[model samples]
Target: MDPKETYSPLNCPKPVAEGIWIFDGLMIRMDLGPFKIPFPTRMTVVRLGDGTLWIHSPIAPDEDLFSAVDALGSVRHVIAPNSIHYWYMADWLERYPGARSYAVPDLATTAKRPFRIDHPLMDGARFAWESEIDWILVPGTKVSEAVFHVPSARTVILVDLIENFEAAKLSSPLMRFMLKLVGGLDPNGMAPLDLRMTFRPKRKQVRERLQRVVDWQPEKVIMAHGRIYDRDGAQELRRAFRWAI
Candidate 1:
């Protein structure tokens, strides 16, 4: 269905469902120490019943983007689903003065932060988002990605539990090769090899979480990086996690 079209013109919010939107941001490179890999940045924005907005994994917000989001609703809650995705909370925190910040329990312990987490709980809900979104935390990974489902939209929001990098979009041969080597390519993308191995020890836990997502039966799966799944989401969930669960 040409999923890349869903994330075009990067840096703008594209509607994914009724109250949900996915913002495609810039291409950022991450250093793996041995080498750097290019990652397409993305984030999700959901408007609450109170007309306030909840931003999942904040990207670098520009003035135009800020104005567009303001038109949608006020940014009241900013969340970092995992340690790797928490880097930009400082920006959203400063932009939305009273917005509460959320993240994994171990985030502030290691990942350097210029900000503080008002809620360090990713499993429980102390806010209104719970009524709309259901989430399961994937254990045994460095990222500790929290996968969420928006029942109203029949959609699942994922940060990095599965990555489907398109070969055509990847410019570097080495990067393409690395992704292919780690089974990060499209049509078969799931957790990378390293994450699969980490999850091996906790396959039962990962299986339980994966089963919950499949049970949601989403119409689409939105990821922070790589092409998204817009159909057969339940079947895709099983295929994607076959390595772990």
Candidate 2:
């Protein structure tokens, strides 16, 4: 799907599953001091049994987006699934002051900006929607990304752990070159080569964690970047992590 066409700040929330909705936001130009490039990003919203919402990897919220979310349910939890994804936490917090914010433990020390983390996400931690949702921390990387599973929808939610960029969608040659170098370009793009290297000595642990996800047999996989895997998700996941496993 073309992110520009599908996700807009002015567009309404798109339903991905029964209780799950997704919002496509503007492409983020990742700036690393000397290096800068744009990458598409997305956010997910999950409504729990109590009618509370869980905002994951939130995008920049505007008045319209906020109003749309409010119509669904009260925002109860804002989750920064990983370190890099926490930049928008402050924005969400300001909008939903009553909502609790949660982030991976590493973000508390690694993140440069200030944000309140009501709770640190732990391995195998359970939530109010435990019966329908499950989560796991993909260990061994500099950033331990938390992957969530919605059993009811047979969907798996990911942050930066896996990416699938389409070359045509990249507007800049530099961005395309960078994505190619990191193996982010589809159709077989998996974890970046550098990220895979970070798992050295702990590849076994990382592989084990991925195995659990594979066993879930997801029918769809939603990621922060690239196209969402709606068919053969389980096979695609295994292929994406082949280097690590």
Score residue 188 of candidate 1 by CA lDDT: 82
TM-score of 2: 0.91
The Cα error of candidate 1 at residue 79, in Å, is 1.0
Worst 10 residues of 2 by lDDT: 2-11
Q: Residue-wise lDDT of candidate 1 within 1-245, one digit each (tens)?
A: 23342356867768878988888887777774487777888999999888989899888888887887888899988988866888888888998889998887778786786577898756655665788778778777555767888888888988778888888887778878888888778878887787677767778888888888888999899888788888888889888877765
Per-candidate Cα lDDT values, in order, are 0.81, 0.82
Instruction: Name every residue pair that clashes in candidate 1.
Output: none
What's the TM-score of each model vs. the native?
0.92, 0.91
How close to the true structure is residue 13 of candidate 1, measured as C-alpha lDDT?
A: 69
